[model samples]
Target chain A: MVLIYIDHSEKEIKKSSHEAISYGAAIAKQLGCSAEALLLGTVNDDLTTLGKLGASKVHQLNNESLNNFDAKVHASLIATTASNLNAEVIVFAHNINGKAIAPSVAVKLDAGIVTGACSLPSLQNGFEVTKTVFSGKAFASIKIETPKKVIAINQNSFGIQNYDSSATIEEMNLPIPTASVKVTNVNKIIGEIPLTEANLVVSGGRGLKGPENWGILLDLAKALGAATACSRPVSDSDWRPHHEHVGQTGIQIAPNLYIAIGISGAIQHLAGVNRSKTIVVINKDPEAPFFKAADYGVVGDAFEVVPAFTAAILKMKHNE
Target chain B: MNILVCISKTPDTTAKIAFTEGNTKFDENGVQWIINPYDEWYSLVRAIEIKEKDPTTNIHLITVGGPEAEPIIRKALALGGDEAIRVNSNSNDSYVIAQQIAAIAKQGAYDLIMTGKETIDYNSACIGSMLSAILDLPYVSLANHLEVNGNTATIQREIEGGEETNEVILPMIISCQKGMAEQRIPNMRGIMAARTKPLKVVDPVATNAHTSIKEFSLPPAKTGVKLIAPDQMEELVKLLKEEAKVI
Candidate 1:
């Protein structure tokens, strides 16, 4: 059987988890097996809805301690669950939590593991998988030779499909281990869409001059209902928060539409946002390297172009 | 008061990526290698900061690679480590690398193990977690802020949409990233001192790589961009809506 690990935060399921379930279900179909889901901790979301994404059954471990993430504890329980269920393949979303836990589980199960996988495995060629390497600059095809394999799919890399079925939720009681780590505080960004889950992102850079000039960029982001981000320099200079920084050393996002303004795209910055489905670069300099990587380019000062662009969008919305 | 910092040598961040041997291997021609930035700027420096505060804390550097990794380890030592160790083997497999480090770490009996969040080349952020699993130690990853007090370490890590603060006991593994510490350059005195530091090279233990790279390929090049006039905002809006269908 193929088992998918469902990741959630604050009682809500992450969008990337749906993609993992869909990917796992397709893999199970390829291997002629059943697809199931392993969800740790309690969530307010309905479990039956997971079947629509692909899982045939959902297993829930309802221990309250499981709500807080402890990589060691999570790995041990996940390894046990996979072993008891005779799962030949395991899948997870290569997000923050998955990146921290998947390898430990793989070590426990003695399974071949692939992280940041962007493509489904090809069984015809002995379970070959493709993943982005060199910071999304290139791709590498890897073959997992172990009998038990673990794969973590990259966010936004796979499509989620809806099916006309509901999954049976089975509540399982498992012994919880003592958590070695204690989470004392959590500071969440409220009222704004997270960059990882945002479909559209508007990012600014040093060319915007300083923190005071971010109003135009924020205005556009607000008008479009998109998330806001900044280049590394912008964040380093304190014009934006560190969490809003999107680059190789910061957060890497692959939104559907990414708008870069006043930012001369450096290779490090491009490594993070190059995977966007559609890229639009706006800069006063016509020779910026970002233009080469963008799908659309506009050579103009962001101060003038952004407000005009936002107005045009508002006008279109008013007409619609 | 012992800390083991793991570092790796990787091609400079700005180096152009290319494959050789029919895309089966990375082409190293004309490539300049440096200690991975995350390792040098964050993990290593953070360890040094802790040592500066406690003076008795010992910082040891470790790398798993061939002899070519020696220079990188020496440079890391100059930053503030007491000694260095290089496992005499090189592999792209994370499992093999983690196993070798775990073997040495078990013998060293260090109180804390540290590594960068991930290498820029392969970007596999698993070594710390895997090592923790192998040694049955606690693991904290992507820690941006760390404060060590006695046997407890308070760490702040980035989550999907928030920052989470956790406290873990000593004898744990952590992967560090930006905001942990400022990058420190090796001065002339530190460089002269690093020459006399002890660097031990040990043979790797027997292990099998679970996965093998079959081929490499570059991402498809972007098509030529459609340049829109700055004044034609309405037209750009139409293109995004009707042509790109992204708005």
Candidate 2:
């Protein structure tokens, strides 16, 4: 059996979870085994629909304590589930929650683990998986010699491919671990598209001058129906919130389109958005490093260029 | 309060990455090594910040590497660590490295053990989480704010599009990131004191590494930038619509 852990937030299933299920199911098909999904906490989305996306069965642990992410607790829960199902492979999306718990689970199960996996394992001769390393500057293919394995799929790597099947939901009464970390408060951005899930992202840096001039970036984002982010320096300087920061140490996103405005592309910054399918850079300095990574480069001041770009996008949308 | 901070010696952020010896090893000919930025700026700094609040608090540093890593360990000591320990193993396996750390952390009975989210070189982001499980301690990752009061630690960790604050007891392990603490530059006093600080060498615990690196390959380089004239906003929009279709 192949088990995929489905992660959710605020009762809603995250987009990455869907991608993981698809990736896991593809692996299951290759190994000629059944793919199943495991959910720790209660989620609002239809578990049956998740089957159509990937898994043949959905096992949910309807425990409230499992809602708040404690790596220790999650790892323990996942390790138990994998064992009970006699799972040969376990999969997780390499998001915040996955990154925190996958290693722990791997240790508990004595499984050979690969995080940030970009492709499915080659089961022809042996289990060989490719993963991103060196902060996305390189790729390393690893062969899992262990009998059981765990893989954390990177976002946007394997997309969701639908299957014409409905999953049977099963409730498991398992012993949930005691939570040591108590969530005191949750400060969440209510409505906008999350940076992790957004297909297109509009990010800025200190090059925009100050926080007061952020309206142009927002306008472009709104016009394009994209999420917004900022470079680490922008967040460090209090020009934007830390949640908006994306870099080697910040949120790693692999959107289809990433628009960087006024951001000089440092290698660390590139690590975060380098996986983006299409990068568009807008900066005044012709020698800015970001352009080298961008698919499209606009060499002009962000102040003059961003507004004009936003206007043209709005015009195109209006015409559409 | 006794805090144990784990740091890694990595190539400087701007160092050119190259492979050597049949692409099996990293070329270190001209690379300048430094303490991983996240370790220096966040993990070690936050522990030092806790120590600064109470003089009784002691901060110790540890890294799993050889003599070449001693200088990086000294850098952490100069930043506010009381002592340093270098595990005598240059293992690239995160699991083996975590075992070494868990062994030291277990013996020390540290109230808090912290490390960066991941090392820049390997970028495994696994040591702290694996160590937490091995030590049977509560663990938090990507912590932006951490404040310890008595036996409880209030930590605010970064979440998707927001933040979540959690309170965990002492003897917890954390993988820290930015916003935890400001960068502290080592002053002359720190540099002088760090040289005389107790630097201990310890043997690594015997454990099998689950993973081994095979080879190194760089990402495909960008071909060429398609520069669009700044004034031609219409042309740019048309290109995006027709060619890129991103908008």
Candidate 3:
């Protein structure tokens, strides 16, 4: 059987988890086996709905302590679960939590792992999987040769597929270890679409001049109902918060539409957003390298272009 | 307190990426190599800051790479580590690299182990958790802020849409990123002192790499951009809606 680890945030299932389930179900189908889900902690979403994304069974481990992420503890529990279920393959969404625990789980299970995997394994050639390497500058096909294999699917790489079925929920009973790490505080960004889960993102850069000029960008983002992000320099200079930064060293996002304004796309910057389905670059400089990578380009000052773009969007919405 | 800082050498961020050997190996010619930015800027600097507060703290550097990684290791030592260890291997396999670090870390009996959130090149972000698992230590990842008091360490890590503070006992592993510490340049005095720092080159223990690279390829190049006139805002909007269908 193939086991997929369901990741959730604040009692809500993450969008990336659906992609992972679909990918795992496809793999299970290829191997002529069943795909099951392992969800840790309590969530408000109906577990049966997971079957539409392709899991045949949803195993829920309900423990209050499990609500908080402890990589060491979670890894041990996952390893034990995989062993008890005779799972030949395990899958996870390669997000923050998955990246933290998948490797540890792989170590415990003595399984070969390929994180940030972009495609399903090619079983015809000894379980080979393709993944992005060198910060998305290139791709490397990795062959995982182990009895038990663990694969973490890259976010937004695999599209979710719906199956016409419902999964039966199974309450799992296991010895939960005491968490060695104690949670003290949580500061969440309220009332904003997270960059990771946002379908559209409007990002600014140093060319915007200063934090005082950010209202235009925010206005455009609001017009489109998109998330807002900044380049590394913008965040470093404190024009934007570090959490809003997206680049090689910061958060990586793969939104459906990514609009880059006043940003001369550096290779490091491109590395983070290159996975976006559609890229639009707006810069006053006609020779900006970002234009080469973008699907659409507009050479104009962001100060004028952004407001105009926002007005156009608002007008379109009003007409619709 | 003893702290082990893990670092790796990577091509300068601005270097053009190209593969040689039938697209199976990274081209090294004309490429400038430096300490990975995350490792040098965050992980090592934060350790140095901790040592500054407590002069009795010992910081050791470790890397699993070939002799070519020496210059980078020296740079890390110049930043603040007292000693260094290079496991004699150039394995790209995370499992093999983690195993080597685990071996050295066990013998050193360090109280805390630190690594960059992820190397800029591979961006696997797995070494810290893997090392902690092998050592049976609590693991905190993507920690942007860290404060230590006695045996307990308070760490702040970013989640999906929020940040969480966690308190963990000593003998734990952490992966650091931005907000952990500011970047520090090595002074001439530190550079001269780093030459004499003890750098022990140890042979790697026999460990099997479960994964091997099959091939390498670049992302598909984008088709030529459709440039829109600045004044034709409606045209651009129409293209986004009717052509690209994104809005």
DockQ for each candidate? 0.82, 0.71, 0.81
Tens-place lDDT digits, model 2, residues A1-320: 89999999989888999999999999999999999999998878989998788799999999877888888888988999899889999999998889899999888888878888999987675888888877888888777777889899998989889899999999999877778889999998887888988999999998998999999999999989999999988998889987788998777789989999999999989988999988999999999999999999999988999999999988888898
Clashing residue pairs, backbone N/CA/C < 3 A, model 1: none
Q: Give TM-score, chain B, model 2.
A: 0.97
| Candidate 1 per-residue lDDT over residues A198-271, each given as its tens digit | 88999999989999999999999998899999999999999999889998888889998999999999999998
Tens digits of per-residue lDDT for model 1, B1-247: 9999999999998899999999999999999999988898999999999999999999999999999998899999888899999999988899999999999998987989999999999988889889978999999999999999999999999888888999999989999988999878999988999999999999999999999999999999998999999999999889989998889
- For model 1 chain B, give the 10-residue run with minimal summed lDDT: B123-132
lDDT by residue for model 2 (B208-236), tens = 87777676778899888899998988888
Off by over 4 Å in 1: none
TM-score of chain B of each: 0.98, 0.97, 0.98
True contacts kept of 2: 0.71
Residue-level lDDT tens digits of model 3 in A1-320: 99999988888889999999999999999999999999989999999999999999999899877888888898889989999999999999999889999999899989899998998899888899999888888899999989899999999999999899999999999999878899899888998988888889999998899999999999999999999999999999999999899988888888889999999999889988999989999999999999999999999988888898899999999999
Local error of candidate 1 at A310, Å?
0.8
TM-scores, all models, native as reference: 0.99, 0.97, 0.99
Which of the CAPRI classes, incorrect, acceptable, medium or high, describes model 3? Answer: high
Reference contacts reproduced by model 3: 0.79
